[model samples]
Target: VLAFTATGFVVAAFGQALGIDTLVVRNAGAIILCLVGIVLLIPRLQDGLSRIATPAAAWASRQQSALDDRAGLWGQALIGALLGIVWAPCVGPTLGAAVALAAEGKDLGEVALVMAAFGLGISTVLLVIAFAARGALARWRGRMMAAGGRGKIVLGGLLLIVGIFILTGVDRQLEAFLLDHLPDRVTEWSTAF
Candidate 1:
């Protein structure tokens, strides 16, 4: 999550520095996200993606093994950080869009905050699953993988729907409405941050 947050911030900053039009970036990001959803929904596309990613994964595995043989705990940490840097962007479309949206404000702090919050949310869920459901997950691992396939489809459809919302500008309208209706204290707190 930390690595993701840092990468997200840099991406936002780079986009801003390039003077890219916000609407264009937002639309492009939405389209990319929708494409990712489509890829997820299609097994053939996933297989293709896997083939493309296999080399990278294999390299990472080898590096992990070498690190384990040499650098001990510190090497493991380094490899983990390297994986996070590489892995985050691949899995970051949802939060990437959020950070891109936040970038429209031209506020680096806001972008960082959004990325941090998103990372924290993901981390919390993963930690909870790792710690609280380890046994149950191990017992049901096979079943869970089957269910996970269905869950991926559902998630893909939802991403498609959200992409449409963002593209159609409904997301902005909803955000505006929420902001308009937010309590003064909430608004004030956010601004203060």
Candidate 2:
């Protein structure tokens, strides 16, 4: 995840150096996010994904365990890495914004720090949920299973709001407003990091 974010930062900085316009990027990202949101919110698409997932799971279950414990460990790590990329749409904007901020400095060290911080922040949430996942899943399995079909709708609703904000420029404006009003102490603390 750290590597992924670092790469994003580096790429953004490179793009900036090549004279790509930030406004163009912001608009493009907003449009893509909105489209994704629309697709997710479509009931038919959710139904299609569900239909496909079942057969795919059954096929996977039928496959023999080809890997020993050691290989299995590495295979799982690889799968997790791939899954992170698959999940990037959910996180791309925040990372992009951070990358753009880092690019302003044109300093490789600053870009690395921004990327590291972004990765660390995201990993913290993931770590907390992962640590508590077993218990949560065990306790809520039946309920979660029951609600599975609706989960996509819930996620879509959230993404729709985020997309709307980004599309209308409210998201960036709000971020800028917050930054302007933020306490110097807080900014200083972050800089200390």
Candidate 3:
């Protein structure tokens, strides 16, 4: 978890572009994310997974559920980390595009610094969403339960958009916009630190 972004930074430092592998990872991750969202949103698929669980090992499923229940916040944190892992690839194109821009006519330290910041930003968002949403959902259990199915479907559609964008190499437009809008002071600070 800690080294995930550092790995990206190191790669950028080496100027090694695993262009195809990165695309593969981004696409596969997107597809899997969409599938997860679909399974959660679709009653039929959800029921099918439950049915599959039953024949595989009824007691194991129940025991796992119990363990999840008992593990509480720690379990939730682990799940959050897993979610971050799954979704990390969705941001790959953006990060890569950003790092490349930052690396252009720059030294290795500068490239790494940019990538490290991007990685921290990505990690922070995932962690915040995971923890904050958990609390919010607990408070709004009834409303959330009602909207949960629809939410997952919306999320799935969003994932598909991100996936398609990366696959098509359209994320560079977003990267361009971000770089254009980034304040000069921020760039100065990034350089200074």
RMSD of each: 4.9, 4.4, 6.5
lDDT string, candidate 3, 106-147, tens digits:
676665566557667767897799988987878899997878
What shift in Å separates residue 116 of candidate 3 from its native position after superposition?
A: 2.6
Candidate 3, 32: how far from true, in Å? 3.9
How does each model score on lDDT?
0.77, 0.69, 0.65
The number of residue pairs in model 2 that clash at the backbone is 0
User: TM-score of model 1 relative to the true fold?
Assistant: 0.65
lDDT score, candidate 3: 0.65
lDDT of 1 by residue, 9-43 (tens): 77667755767565786687689779988988999
- Measure candidate 1: CA RMSD: 4.9
Ranking by TM-score: 2, 1, 3
lDDT of 1: 0.77
TM-score, candidate number 3 = 0.53
Clashing pairs in 1: none
By TM-score, the best candidate is 2
Greater-lDDT candidate between 1 and 3 = 1
Error of 2 at 86 (Å): 4.6
lDDT of 2 at 113: 68
Off by over 4 Å in 2: 17-25, 51-70, 84-94, 146-151, 176-193
Clashing pairs in 2: none
| Residue pairs of candidate 3 with colliding backbone atoms | none
Of candidates 2 and 1, the better by lDDT: 1
Give the worst 10-residue stretch by lDDT in candidate 1. 87-96
